[model samples]
Target: MAAKRPVDRPRPTLLIILAAALTLLTLQFRGLQPLDAFQQGVRDIVEPVRSLSDRLTDPVQTAWNGVFGFEALRLENERLEVELARMRGNALTSEADTELLNRLLSEVDIAYSDFDAVVVRILGQPPGNFSSHMIEVDKGTDDGIEEGMAVVTGAGLVGRLEQVDRSRSLVQLATHPDFRVGVRLVTSQDEGLAKGTGTEGILRIESGVRLDAQVDNDEVLVTSGGRSLFPGDIPVGKVLDPDSDADYRRSIIIGLAADLENLSFLKVVLPAEKPEGMR
Candidate 1:
């Protein structure tokens, strides 16, 4: 009664070993049917516990999602806003361009005497050190734009077509060093050669007057009829400074009337026919 028997302990251990061996043999032969049934029973018991665990952790998972997802959402919103602003700017520019083209085409078709005109878009810009006066247009001999053709904008005279290719033309602005046009000063009633200085807004006038000649600033200058390229009586520039020494050959500086830097559209005026007079 006081001592436990060794046979009892051995019997329990043998029974446990026999049970484990039988379970393994059954799994190997019959594909674990009994074990699957036992696992299903265990799942039924643990389902409530798993549900409780998920409920306890729901707020933490939600907060983690908000922290990570908010960054991507904010970046997407910023990109959309920037795209909207860019499209709006493009729309406004398109409207302004349409209005300008309508006005220029109508005015040129009616006012010009015997010359046909072709509108051209500026493709490339000249170097900045070249006074930003000259530009390249997208039209050339293919569009009937040839060398020595006059280029003008809605505001005033822009330049002259210098070199022409099959599809492109180089425009030498009124400020080019090689540019010379006959101009008449309105205020002084003085006629002189308006020549370019290769600098922005600068033109030089070589007056052929005598030592008694005198002129003031802010004089309105217009193109003379003697020029072969540009039209006659077109507004060109305004006088800025007169020569200090009037006794010598006086060279007056003039400022161009047009903004050559921001030329988007221009028209090339074809050569006009000579009128039948005194021939």
Candidate 2:
């Protein structure tokens, strides 16, 4: 007889698994005490591992959230800084504009009240040879400004309008070498011709008063309106010294009332016949 052939063992099947799971479920449903004890043992073995996994992941989740939050905060801070810079720039601009407006209004109210005058912006210094002695203004014939009109500031006379265009004018500052005005000493009976020296902050008074006249230091000078070049009583300057030099014995040095180097706004006094209006 040939050796008996070995029989193959059958593999476990899905039907067997289904039957086992159904039997456990039925026992638990019937409240079998032994099944409850087995379920409790499974939970006790798995619960600690589940809790350890949750604890490990919690810190990592928190760190990740913190990194993203830091980035968000950085972006928000940058946005706020940009907005603040823009607002600061706007505030500075508004303050500058308000200050300029107040200054212009004060010029109108205080200085040019005696005559119909045009308030003009000093555009800039004139170009080339005239730059040191003259400035350009933004109003001209169209604004009723004309050559020879007196230009002044709140402080006192600045110059006369030298040239006029349709919409612009040139001013010859009072310090020009060719400029001259009649002036009188406020404290003394001395009358003189106040003349520009073509130099900054200096004027020459060639008076007919005797050299021995008591013209003290800091004596005020005012326009005499002799030739009608300027109105009477406008403050010109205060005496600085009576030069005793051989060539300038009758002359004295004085400081100007108006600050020419920092001129900003001007008023052009209209001719006596021109009607009052603003540009």
Candidate 3:
């Protein structure tokens, strides 16, 4: 017997597949209702598998998204923080500008409103043993600021311009030991000399009111303007106490009206021609 020969099995031709696809397409285009039912049946069989696959992968996709989204959330938070800080800075600047404008307006409304004056910002405090006794202002002789000119704030007297340069002037604070101003009691109509005690925000009255004169606590003191240093009626301070002896001469302590520690803006009274009929 001869060895058995292998026979080749027949495979479907490409033409047969093309014919089958064309048949399905033609049936579908012709609105064949049976083809639609057959397609729906196939989809129903595949739908359960797809739904199960999505359920199996859902937690893993969620965890992956959370891991990546955390960084995105962190970056967003940092951006917001920077924006908030910028807004806060702008708010502070606006508040400061408003305060400065109000202060300048108030200072302009004082007794020197009609007088020629210059508004100067305090540049620094001079350095030395008298550092506490004086502050530096941004105005100088070039701006018509001169020594002996009085410095004042909206509240009251701050000091007198002492050393003046071309662009800056030093203010001798009224609290300096040698500082003196003629003051009059508002209530008693008595005049007195107020002297600084080398202490901050304090003054001592001397050589004006006699011991027999009536002086009371909390009495307001204003400049007498006798010596041409300060304008008359500028507030000096309030009387704290009276000190009198057998000589019938009295001295009193004064609490300053201006808050020296927080001085920022001031007015320098310029020398002007004395008005007719005015001292």
Candidate 4:
């Protein structure tokens, strides 16, 4: 009787209780189906850690996208910039060619057969006070550009060839202080010596010409060949204003018919001996 059945251990009941406690802990930790304060506390603590983890991984995702997207965007930007530059360059070149063509056509129409010449491009602007009104051209003595030869463009007379080298020439613009033209007003047919005064595109017409002369603004002035430095009948400039009493000669200010400030092309005329009959 004393050795009857081994005493049944309470282990099964303890295990059952332990398992229930563990299940309750797991539910609480997982915030599952429990609205208790303990569960809410667990959830609050874990929520911030999870949010931090997602934030930390965001940079990596961004970097991965950049590896593929960055090159495409960078290349596209470069291509667009290059294209824009090319288009601008093309437009500028087209404008320049158009100007040169017009100049050549005018030369032909004027029957300037005495000069064996082609259009030359202006390379750079001059550097001194005189340079502001003058330009350096791509022509030289080797190209038959002689000093004192007249330089003209499509719009009008630009200047006279000043300095000449074997490969280049300097043009003295009509606005230069030394520049003088024996010009006649188109409207009044009044003759005067037009001399540059070295101001903003202004010329002094000798006062001997009538002060009250009815020369309108933009009246065409042309070379009259009085002094013989320039050929006769070449377009010179347009009258900007009539002379005032304070101004010398009540001078008719002149605006150069050619855009001297922005010239790109020019034509040089070789000195031609005036025909006896024409003279």
Better of 2 and 3 by lDDT: 3
Q: Which stretches of candidate 4 lie over 4 Å from their true place?
A: 1-117, 126-130, 244-248, 274-279
Cα-based TM-score, every candidate: 0.52, 0.54, 0.56, 0.52
Q: After superposition, which runs of candidate 2 have C-alpha atoms over 4 Å from their true positions?
A: 1-113, 244-248, 271-279
Candidate 4 local lDDT, 1-279, one digit each (tens): 555457755689789999999998888678665435554456446645645865697698679868977987798789989989998879978687556544633543433334544488886664456476678777665675667778888666778887665556678877778887787665567888888777755676765467666777666677666575877666777777765453433656788777665456889865566445421
Clashes of each: 0, 0, 0, 3
| Candidate of highest TM-score | 3
What order do candidates take by lDDT, descending? 3, 2, 1, 4
Candidate 1 segments whose C-alpha is farther than 4 A from its true place: 1-116, 126-133, 209-211, 274-279
Cα-based RMSD of the predictions, in order?
32.8, 39.2, 37.3, 34.8
lDDT, residue 6, model 4: 70
Worst 10 residues of 3 by lDDT: 104-113
* Total clashes in model 2, counting residue pairs 3 or more apart in sequence or in different chains: 0
lDDT agreement with native, every candidate:
0.70, 0.73, 0.75, 0.69
User: Taking the tens digit of each residue's C-alpha lDDT, what string does model 3 give over 1-279?
Assistant: 956556633355567878999999998999898986685566446645645865698798779868988897788789989979998879978687557534533443434355567899886665457577888777766686767888887667788987776566689999998788888776677887888898888999878787887777766677777675877667777778866443655668999988887567999876566546432
Model 2, 2-98: lDDT tens digits are 5654663334556687889999999889989888667546644654564586569879867986887788778878987997998787997868754
Q: What clash pairs does model 3 have?
A: none
Better of 2 and 4 by TM-score: 2
Give the lDDT of residue 228 in candidate 2.
61
Q: What are the per-residue Cα lDDT tens digits for candidate 1 across 1-279?
A: 667765567778999999998988778578666765564456546645645765687688678868987897788789879978998879988687546544533443324323467899886663356535567777766676677877776655678997665556679888888888877765555678878898887889885433445666665566665644577656676678877576678888888877786467888876566345411
